[model samples]
Target: MLPSQSNPNPWSESEPAEWSHYSDLETLIIEGAYSTKQPQAILDDYYIDFKQKRQISNIDSNKQRPIKRVQRKRDDKHLREERFMDLPVGTGRSFSGEYGWVSPFIIEVRRHLGLQPDQLPSKDPQLIPMLVEKAAQGIITEAIHIRKQREAEKLAEVLLEKKNKKMKEVWQCCAYLYTLESFLYKTINAAMRLIGDKDHEEVWRSKVGTLGPFCLLLWDDPYNTKVTIEKTLYRGANLKPEQIAAYEEMAKHKNEYRSFQAYTSCSRNRKKAE
Candidate 1:
């Protein structure tokens, strides 16, 4: 036959039980539910405040609550797993197999997070794992924005250079036209004065007197003329040698054998008419 159990309650027989003598019925009703087993004795022995105990219980419940795992994207995962040092500077993009601590970027992020210098984690990999996706997203967004801004600045600089080049070409062309016009005026005046002189035939015999204007028109000095124009027009420009030679040849062929005096007379008459 089995030994007779002394305890009346079946639960008390299987599980260990504790007894408390309550002074008042109100106290018993209030504390009875929580005073079961050995827990109440441990609480009492430690002199733990009821409110503090409740707070501890609350903390335990919070610990038990399920934490939602952040789902990382392929790119995000790569960024997180990769060494910050391997990421492209000023861009959030990651390179293949790049692993290292990007000290500057990490420092920047820590500053943004309001973390102090001493509070920075010893290891980059260890700290990165705890970073939420949102925070990482902010860092990436800032990096991308910086990259775009830099690109825009570079584009602006290129456009400005192009504009300056075009302006220089226009100025060179204007200067060449002015010089050509001045030469034409001087030649016309000399021809008009010499045409009526008794020494007109003699003047024509001397090539210097008759062809002086043509020589002046073909002046190709490095300091003040043809070479200067070439250098100015082609400065910092992309032009083939053949292209420059072809242009020069074309220029030399123009206005050949043209009657300068006759053209000048016509131009003056046209101006007077206007």
Candidate 2:
């Protein structure tokens, strides 16, 4: 690679704990060389996790479906339980019944996108168009899986038809952040809200914990590499003394890394950060 070209991170010899949730295929792609160009087969693998695909296959071959559990988000008591108390607990045999005996992940996607229980996106094609911009490809992949699992093969086909639609949106959102994050205040307020004792930790964990690492990884890679390389970054500015103190309370010494859960902001512009 040229000096100007990115020195892509090579596959790690030891697997990372962060990647434990990734399927074998996903791991292979990440753990191996970063291929800038994606092939069609790789793209196909991008949508549905291989393990989930295998589960569906096994269900077909044995004619005996194993009882499966959708991995629950941590600390679901605050947001999911309280906000989504109306989530139906029963199952249904058709695609039209999203509220029916569907996986919890499906319910989460619906809720995240502001859909009603038992409301199928099929009934409102405009709903997909409206959400396509904000929808992450990974979540859409889960939706596709449920659609397929329900014997509503056609809906899955439609969802997969333009797999990159949501992906492009995600890319754009990331790109927007790269230039300027007007949402910094919103993000800071969110961090401020997350600051607290174990109960608050549980609530935040249940709500946005799944996104925390990925968002951190995104923030780390590009801004550090593309924007702030060899440049100074600042924090503890514009923040109230209490907010900074809160961060100090939460900070922990993790090996060489000082890990803190919340209560600070980072910026390249020193004055702006302050």
Candidate 1 structure quality by residue, lDDT tens digits, 1-274: 0011223342354655433222121122224434553232111112112332321222243321111112222343222222111211221111111122222223334455565655422222233223322222322233243332222222223223333233233234323332321222233234333322344534422323323322222221123422222221111112355545644665597553211121122112332222
What overall lDDT goes with each candidate model? Answer: 0.28, 0.32
State the weakest 10-residue window (summed lDDT) of model 2.
Answer: 89-98
Candidate 2 C-alpha lDDT tens digits along 195-218? 333344454445332333223222
After superposition, candidate 2 runs with Cα above 4 Å error:
1-169, 175-196, 209-231, 236-265
Off by over 4 Å in 1: 1-184, 192-198, 204-274
- Scored against the true structure, residue 237 in model 2 reaches a CA lDDT of 27
Q: What value does the lDDT take at residue 100 in candidate 1?
A: 26
